[model samples]
Target: MTTEPREPRATDVLTGLLADLRAESAVLDDLVAGLAPEGWAADTPAAGWTIAHQIAHLAWTDDWAARSVRAPEAFTTETARSFGELLAAGLDPVDEGAARGAAEEPAALLARWRAGRDGLLTALAAAPGDARLPWFGPPMKAPSMATARLMETWAHGQDVADALGAVREPTARLRHIAHLGVRTAGFAFSLHGQPAPETPVRVELTSPDGELWTWGPADAADRVTGPALDFCLLVTQRRHPDELALTAAGATATAWLPIAQAFAGNPGKGRAAGA
Candidate 1:
């Protein structure tokens, strides 16, 4: 007798994503665990950011995310204050925030990150099903917020791995990142002050587990096809388009490759080829 496949339930999906977030966090934590003081101070691929700064920024964001869910008014007040200070100083908020976070003692920074991550995860898991959390760009529900956190952790971890010349094995969890990349094509165009292409762009990715994952219309003329890992790296700005094996078939899709950003906020100066 033939058996039917089981459809994923909402709870199961969230649980799986939370597991991936925890796994990604553990990978970064283990990578940093053995680093000496000098290692923590080593500059990453992101200009002017050290390994410590990367971890600290993740911690700081996690703290705010938890607050965004648990105490929205307080979070909004604090965020406004921080933005005002950054504007008054004429400094890029992201860069200055990371720099300030880098000043903490290495051990203390790590401890703070651990606590913040734990708290954020706890809050997210227990959040009401219909609740939304505010962020710098937009309000997100539990799943989207968790996925964004996972993407950020993985992306920054890549910077640390690159800084230390460590090779990171590809994982199936990258599917989430790739999905986010494909979903944000319109937002990517909007960030560049261009009209979003009306034509849907087809994305075909070969997952690490040797399965094909696709998004968009299958018969669309514009297409991007590549390994899931490369797509994730491209969207995260961790790797330039030229450095990856990704291919684009139409003008809109081709142009999108260089400017695609899955993360929120202003468009970043993405890396140069092979940088």
Candidate 2:
């Protein structure tokens, strides 16, 4: 005589994800909202990037996501020319976005980022549930798009937290980051020039609140087991794999740990073991 949990309706997908995205962004905003101008200029772990760069990167990417959602055809036309020019000049379009946004006055940048991300949330909510939008890597539907934004917001928020010497309380939103990490295991291998394995790898993580989260077949031969936070940080490249306690039981999972990337585009050079 037990009742099972009800499954989420299809309509709840984007609605729920957008809410999580907003909450994560708000958390980061709280961390930086009252920073002195010097705080904005402080260096983050991303080498040359300052705190301003982190927020700017989020804003810039949010704007791009809005454009893609509102107009996919136009998005393609616009990115093809601009991205090509950036690549032709040996510059990464992603870096270019951060550089440009980071140069804005702190107050102005903060305001613009708030507006841009709010606009993106609106656009995402209005999109057809099954409609695909253009992206830097693969096209994504509204829900996946929102989840990706949440993942980046949390990842970059970690950098800001580290820079400010603040300790953030890990929350349930980290579940989004953990899920993206597991989903991108194949992409990690593909990006590193290996054939993506046909078999799925089981991922079991202990969440912040002591809940268990999992992905893939329960009986899969390959497996990744760790705290959800460590897995999230590893996939986001926020910390070196060696710096975390993640365990990989099979060849594919072990190889994936070093290259796992939740974000799109080329893999980052990554951090030293204890950096």
Candidate 3:
């Protein structure tokens, strides 16, 4: 009997992530369209960030990554080693808004966001697979770089969706985010100073269009199974799995839930930017 092949190209993953970004951006745009001017300035679920701030942060991050990609050699080895640390330890950008008393205008923030995102898409589309970029650790290829952006955009967008009391429907493109979450399982546990649990957990996602997506050892004794939206929210730390009907069949699987991280480093001691 013949077996199926796997798709592991980082470039392909980045391409998919870009598509998800566009999709989630559309949903966010729609959500913002009906908001009153005050709503745009309203603080998000995050500690001190408003919708405008969140959008601005995304734009800033995109420009940062693109700059790094365009000039990897400019970064020192120490900079690379300290990448994860800086990201984890840095103060929240939006929190500084408290001192300023208000956020930038929403319309201006949105325009800034769109420009950054479009610029990133253009850069990634033209980048080669081996294009190196400065990251929290060492350097990353264009594909990994794209994945990082994808994870951020989706995770942050969840905060916006939650703040609006609206749910952004999950799509097949979420597989990329799901992949990042699965890959980061070990780091997530370690961020809490615990050893990675030995038990393997299965993950199954039913896509919006009714297709099934899965990961982990096929016969692993533990599992997380649910709609892709819930899985994404749980892994992204936007919602607690137990509260969201996410099924975990073993102790290790349950433990992994609280610390399941998708981003590169320790997300630190609490909820993410917009969750």
lDDT of each candidate versus the true structure: 0.90, 0.90, 0.70
Model 1 ranges with Cα > 4 A deviation: 1-7
lDDT per residue as tens, model 1, 1-275: 99899999767777888899999999999899889999999999898899999998898888888998898889889899988998899997777778877898999899999999999889888876667778997787888888999999999999999999998888999998888888788889999999989988899999998999999898999999999999999999999888899999998899999999999999989998778
Model 3 per-residue lDDT tens digits across residues 78-169:
44444546557774333442323235566766776778778888877777777677765436777767777877787777777777777766
Question: For model 3, where is the 10-residue window of minimal lDDT?
Answer: 93-102
Name the runs in model 2 displaced over 4 angstroms. 1-6
lDDT of 2 at 128: 90
Task: List, residue by residue over 1-275, the lDDT tens digit for candidate 2.
Answer: 99999899767877888998999899999999999899999999988899999999999999999999999999999999999999999998888899998999999999999999899999999999889899998999888999999998998999999899998888888888888877887787889888888877999999999999999999999999989989988988989888898899998787788889999988888777766
User: Which pairs clash inside model 3?
Assistant: 83-136
lDDT of 1 at 133: 77
Score every model by TM-score.
0.96, 0.96, 0.80
Query: Which candidate, 2 or 3, has the higher TM-score?
Result: 2
| Candidate 3 residue-wise lDDT at 89 | 76
